[model samples]
Target: MLKRLWLILGPVFCAALLVALLLVFFPTKLRHDFEAEKRSAVTLTAASFKGRMQKVQALTDANHRFVPFFGSSEWLRFDSMHPSVLAEKYDRPYRPYLLGQRGAASLNQYFGMQQMLPELENQTVVYVVSPQWFTKTGYDASAFQQYFNSDQLTSFLTQQEGDAAAHHAAERLLQLYPNIAMADIVKKVADGTALSASEDQFVGLMARINKRQDIFFSSLIPSYNRHYDQRVLPELSRLPDEFSYQELEKVAIEEAKEHTKSNDLGIDDKFYKKRLKAKLRELKGAQKNLSYIKSPEYNDLQLVLNQFAKSKANVLFVIPPVNEKWMAYTGLREDMYQQTVEKIKYQLESQGFTNIADFSKDGGKPYFMQDTIHMGWLGWLEFDKVVDPFVSNPKPAPAYHLNSAFFSKEWANYDGDVKEFGNK
Candidate 1:
């Protein structure tokens, strides 16, 4: 019986040993596909959002250029004129490597940048900042916890001096991650205390291990979202033989009309029927009391600016408008909405991060928003018009003069004119 058992387990043990030997000896034995990396440039899955290996690979690829499109659900809209589809259909000079999904706000995006600092250095990036993200309470803890990677925190803690951004990052992590795996280290940073020599050694060691682990396992995982796979490639067939804004907008309008026929709100039919049609009446005036003027997001946004400034990245910040009819139905104030836009613009311009595609006043235009607050139809076409030239052509690098004061609670709560950005 013992001999038979040894025979059964011996081969398995040897195989495991050989695999371990290969990992320790031939670390580079695992190969990756650049084609998959190309496909992943358009993949907007959560895994792709957090994984840095795929991003570094595509961003560094010599032949093709992939710009990082940092935003939330807007990227998933994937309408005929969406940035990704349009880029592929037109065979533009660059492809977009989308980096966020639902609930991925400034706080989530800031930390996600930590692990890819080297790749991001000097790269041009597009960030679509949504006004809807700014609320009275700021981002939800559960939501932040869901999209953030622990390795990202490890990378953050390893490089931080517990400065204002570091302090705020540590504090937010403390709140969102009550029992975080690295709570002890995070606590020290939050308290403005340095990690002990041993803690430093531990962090450095873990960083090495995490780096290797990420390299080893990332390829095993598919970077593509894998949703509507059948439709992703065939989408190219739907585009006009050549690029024409008038022709494309007509298609966009046609699509918007067909998808939004079931609702007066101009929201997609399936989304309306399943999500809003039943609650339509109750939603009226429900958003009247909500305010975007005061929130921690302003400070959270400062962290992103600080990162971009540090990296010297050429960036285009796209500020989108909400659906005006839906806003009126819900009694949301447009003046207040404009104030939010102005405040965000002030934060960007005051620091010399000046390239902006402000569509703040375009919400009232027909079919501009797919739903209450996301871009659609003519909105995307107009967006493409502005964005295409910016990315297609070269521009002078921005000179950022970052102010730590933006991270203060005062600025986070301030809702003043652009001229009085700090005076208020």
Candidate 2:
């Protein structure tokens, strides 16, 4: 009887001990080893934008502080080799962590902000905005989802400031047992757990999982974790280095040659006048009064600002200029665009976000842009100059410039008698 009892008790004790060891060590080791692999992965792709973000995320994860400049392709010309606005001209001390993706408008920036939130709390961040983003179309779904698509992100974004605990708790739950929640739902569905439930419930669960598939990496990955680097491909290391001044010059020359060859370079004096007249005609024909202030994109912008207000991050918003030539080609009026700027300014100032540089109506300076949208080197230099004082220490109440002197209502063929657009 004693031998039989010993046999039963011994096996039970062994099983309990094994379970304890696995519980304490397995997950921890898995996370640790994965991060170790990620650090090596970063060096493999350091030159690429995704790799740069990964590197910064890792550094932030490690608790190292750095400034962040968030925007779209328009800001790609920003020179990090120079001193940040935060530093003295001679000091060149602060290193900015630039976060951007092509066509990343307002909504994408919001999601990008979400991506970097864990590391950015209480840090200084420079955010760039384009007026076109306020238009009806706003950001497309693909652009927004490419950077931010995850179950945990949905919870964090939808919650309030006081729900920080809930946000963190939700994040921990998802990271610890990924796909578990979804799996349980699937099991319940199979077991007829909600047989009488509405169609919306089923649709919602499937939608949630579908959204999860777009996430290349979840926000749960520690910003500094080296193991997180494994998500990057080794081939990324082979990418070319950052664009050099010489390379830009070469590209510009090539583009000019192509333009001349294609007769896209119109030399006749009447060409621009005809083009402007045609654009005015088109604008008049459309007859759509764009209420940009009430658009969904503006609502998203408000959400972004609200998130910033809740955090400890010091925010600076830059409103870059659009090309006059491109504006006409696109059939967008200078006056209407000016109105959009005012609406943005009013909304931001109302929310106490007054640190804005309104270069949106800068008479469409050709030197400032490569084309209608992207900044050329001179444009970036101008941006750097304007941005410097704001980022510096001994911080003063930031300056605001409407730059109306650089633009005219006459360009849009608006009656000269009409009042100048302000924050009305």
Candidate 3:
């Protein structure tokens, strides 16, 4: 009986040993390890991630208090590298650390603050809030879960145990599974080629992923609409013969009308200028309701904001500037625009958030690029100028300049030229 049992078990035991030997000697695919390493490297090298971690470490090591500048990509585009503008304006030494990431919503910033709280004792925190941020649902927490450990995230979320929205975000992230197989395949392909090891490899991968993610998420999320106007519409209308310009034009006009009607703003000549004005008004009014503000995604955002405020972090909400050409195409009326500004002012006063800055009307011309929602260098410079005094003083009324030259007339002309060409 013993001999028979040994014969039956011997093969199984031998197979297991063999498998172990293969793993130890020949090793599993470098692709899997390489992919994991690549992901780690990307996370480590991310400007926002690295910056935040450094700040946390610096504070922890020195046992000194520091200021944290938090927001989304819009904040990152502002004076992150140099404190010169801040130092000069404040008349004191300043080292403002950026904790903003591209595509991150307000909830992400709030979560980030929670994670860094242990190191943030007696630290000054400045938040940059955009009107759009208040409308965000929550953080795409799953995206960053790989970079952070479960225990760390759990502890952070525990602070918001009573908040339903926060709990939902935590649950969603916990349920996410990394696409290890695909990640391994891509990493192998990246490693096999010289391109993978290039200095720009990580950046290139990130750029590609970001582009794909933007397209994917925009399609998935109902609220992530890219409102095309004279600036972007013209380009889309000029797409190669693969797309029907006539069809696109019809769609644009119909959509524009729908937007105007829904918002109770007037649409003239198939443009939604009145609606834009109304949106501005709504933004202005948001300042008045300190306890609750309506947004595209109000329920989730309010909780996030409340958490941040309660934590004693100064929040600076910034409304990104729109393109002048787009405004022209959409037809933003003056009275509507003025009303919007007043509402925003009221909201700021109501909330007692003096650190807020609105760049939505950068000299009435569009400050964003035609193809992308991102601000151009000129716009970024203007944003920097506006926020400079505040970062320095944190008490003075933030200054704003409305110079015509501050806008890119070249871009405006391009829009006009496109329209003329289209007409011809």
Candidate 4:
């Protein structure tokens, strides 16, 4: 019996040992192949992915203290060139890194910070948060699980203690297994390789991907608008045009239900409208919960804020500016917007975030393209106008300095420079 068992186990044990040896010996190549395949399979534009990856790489490579700008696409629209321009304008050095992704909500941003905490722990962090982030419903923690699982992110989070980091990391890992696995593979491959890419490659890739995402999303915009007008508007018309608050509330609830049921890809006005309404409800709830001082989300945000405040890192929370037309079209009232702003201010002030700046109320021209959520160059320019100054003259306590060494080199090669702005 012992001889038979040894024979059966011998081959299995040898195979396992061989595989371990391979991993130990050719880790980079194996990791590279895995990453390349994973990246190639991603449906989003390559430039976007590259930009995000670059930020992670930069963080990993940085020996000096660093500051990162965090948010979704709205913040992504910030032109790196504008920082140089702003630096020239103010005659100050500018060191800013963009860490934004399209379609990312508030929860996503929170998770991003958690995953990036390792490199970010002692660094300055500026967060561009919108009320929309607070208003997003359904805690789809899974949305960010894959991101948290990446080797870099996992390594970073493991080093961070406290309830928030551990709780979020565990929850996200379980929810986004495939993503986590993919990220791990990418990190394993990226290890030891230069974190930075060639300037030309970075810009070329970003422009290409931006164009692709725009073209894809733009093609769908007209149809979405048409559907909103013909189908959704008519249904919403069933409610009185000038409705009382209670009547509007009833309409919002009923419309949300019907919209969820009629969900389709062709034209999803009801679906979009429903999400907007749900977000509004969440904003209102944040306001109510603020009075009580016991809201879990609010509390969580406060905890992170406190952590940020005490660290040597400079932290700023920026609220991205949105198109006024979009707000009006979505039936958002001025009072509603103001109340939301007030709530945000209260939260920031209560948490002692004097370095914070909220731009959600910035009354700028609609820089977004028609029927889509992305910002065009003009919008990006406007975004930079607000951000360049702050980054150039970062608050003294956090002690963030612009790393022009990274900027003046490869960044100058890209189309992101101020001179190339109108050519496109």
- The most accurate candidate by lDDT is 1
lDDT of each: 0.82, 0.47, 0.40, 0.41
For residue 23, model 1's alpha carbon misses the true position, in angstroms, by 6.6
Assess candidate 1 and give its TM-score to the true structure.
0.91
Give the per-residue lDDT digits (tens) of candidate 2, residues 214-233.
22232334445332233223
Model 1 bad stretches (over 4 Å): 1-34, 223-228
Best by TM-score: 1
Candidate 3: tens digits of C-alpha lDDT, residues 174-265: 43434422333233332332223552455344433333332332223222112212222233322233333344344434443433343332
Arranged by lDDT with the best first, the candidates are 1, 2, 4, 3
Model 1 Cα lDDT, one tens digit per residue, 245-315: 87898888888898888878788777779878888889999988878999999989999998888888989
How large is the C-alpha RMSD of every model relative to the true structure? 3.1, 13.2, 20.1, 18.0
TM-score of 2: 0.53
What's model 2's lDDT at 19? 55
Tens digits of per-residue lDDT for model 4, 1-424:
9889979998999998875555344322111132222222121332333223333434554332234666555533222122222232233343344455565544444545543455565565667665554442323455444333233343333333434433443344444453443343223233322223453354344434433333333223222223223322344334444524355345434533333343222112543465544565444323322221112233334435544544555666765544455544444554555555555555565444666665556534432221124333343345555565566565544433322121121221222322232233
In the predicted model 4, the residue pairs found to clash are 95-402, 146-180
Instruction: Give the C-alpha lDDT of model 1.
Output: 0.82
- All candidates in order of TM-score, best leading: 1, 2, 4, 3
Q: Which structure is stronger by lDDT: 3 or 4? A: 4
